[model samples]
Target: MRERVGVYPGTFDPVTNGHLDVIQRAARLLDRLAVGVAINAGKGPVFPLEERVELVRAETAPIAAATGCAISVVPFEGLLVTFAREQGAEMIVRGLRAVSDFDYEYQMAGMNHRLDPGVETVFLTASETNQFISSRFVKEIARLGGDISSFVPQLTLERTLARVRDQAGE
Candidate 1:
């Protein structure tokens, strides 16, 4: 049997619980899952690409072990489909948080399909409890000194708080 590989690409500025939820679910379905940490400069991430990758790698370590799935965290640049192709992933895993996310993801999936017919896009809806968590919101909460412990894992929570404090000179 051919090994099933999938890529879950995201700009995990600070890996959130919601992202981990998607990763956990996706990991169980694929033999090898590549957690693609995208370097999206336009978003002006609080954590650098390397830090983001490290945080994600740390948070996902447990999930990989528990699920017995091979998970690799790789920093990526350029088109997502191109990255997936390079990783030899047959599918792209997407996590949909709400209806708002659908419109954007639908277009992206269609375009990716057009770009490469072989790689399929699969959407996984966020777990009910995590549906409302977004990195943008989590950052806002952290910047305002609000508790974000539930939104992110311990490693991300600590790093994000430290980064926000450092940036604010607090």
Candidate 2:
């Protein structure tokens, strides 16, 4: 049987719980999953690419074990469809947190399909408890000394707080 491979690409600035929620669920549906850490310098990431990739790998380890799906963390840049192709991904997994996300995801799906007809885009809805969690909001909350414990994993929370503190010269 041909193994099913899926790619979940994201900047994952701080690896929020919402992102993990999608990844865990997506892993269940594929034989192999590639967590693509995008080097989107335009987003001005707090954790940097290598750190983001490491954090994602660490965070997804348990999920990969639990789902018995092989998950590999890889750094990617440029067009996501191209990355998907390079990773031999039959589909691209994306997380939708709200109605507002649908429009953009829908258009991107269409474009991706046009670019590579063989690959499909799949959308996973974020868990209700994590639906509102975003890396940007988590960073903001941590920067201002607000509690973000509910939004990300423990290690991620620690790193985010430390990074924010460093950025603030605290």
Candidate 3:
């Protein structure tokens, strides 16, 4: 039988609890999960690629260690579908938190399917506790000096706030 490998691609400036939940659940469904950190020069990231990758690696290590799932941290520079094909991933795991996200993700899934006919997409709903979490929202909240401890992991919250502060020159 062919291995069920999944590719979870995202910017993941700082991996959050929500992302962790998706990765943990996806790991159970697939033999291997490649967490692809996408790099888009058009969209300037608050954290550098290395820092973002390290954060994701650190946050996901425990789950990978426990589940014995082959987890890899790689950068996706070009087309995401192409990257998934290169990694031999049969599925692309995505998290949907709202109707708006569903619409966007659905469109992207279609595009990916067109690019790679063999690859499929699996959508996972965000846990109720994380339905309100989003990187944009988190960054804006921290930029406004608001607390976001409830929405993100403690370690990630601190790092996010520091990055926001630095970016804002506060």
Candidate 4:
């Protein structure tokens, strides 16, 4: 087995429980998992790249430790396939929560295959409990002063809400 490695790339402005679920499930399928945090300067991020990376790293540490699968927190600056190739990953894991995301993600997966036929994408359906969880939704809830502690980890919830409040001038 040539080291079953997978790369899960996303913006992950604030890591949510849904993302955690995907990572946990994907980790089981690979010997090493790379969660690539894509930094697109064109689309401004609520949490800076460093802070986002740290939050994801801290939250995923326990899982990585338990699974004995290395979790690398990388900043993706190019095409996702390119990043996956650089990391030596043979699979690109995608988390699908709704049908709406399918069209786009399917297209992306096809494009990735075209780029590197060796790299394949595996889609993991979101658990029913996490079907409604999204970073954008979490941020909106926190922005309105609603508690999102139930949706995300305590540390992440606190930091995300604080960031939202700061951005909203509240």
The lDDT leader among the candidates is 1
> Candidate 3: which stretches are off by over 4 Å?
none
Candidate 4 lDDT over residue span 8-81, tens digit each: 99889889999999999888878999999989877678999999899999999988988888899998898998
TM-score of each: 0.98, 0.98, 0.93, 0.96
Order candidates by TM-score, high to low: 1, 2, 4, 3
C-alpha local distance difference test of each model: 0.95, 0.93, 0.86, 0.90
- Alpha carbon deviation, residue 68, candidate 4 (Å): 1.8
Instruction: Looking at model 2, report the run of 10 residues with the lowest lDDT sum.
Output: 154-163
Off by over 4 Å in 4: none
RMSD, each candidate, Å?
0.8, 0.9, 1.5, 1.2
Across 138-161, the per-residue lDDT of candidate 2 in tens digits comes to 888898899999889998888888
- Residue range 1-170, candidate 1, lDDT tens digits: 99999999999978899999999999899999999999889999999998999889999999999998899999999999999999999999999999999999999999999999999999999999999999999999999999999999998898999999999995
What local lDDT does model 1 show for residue 134?
Answer: 92
Model 3 residue 134 lDDT score: 81
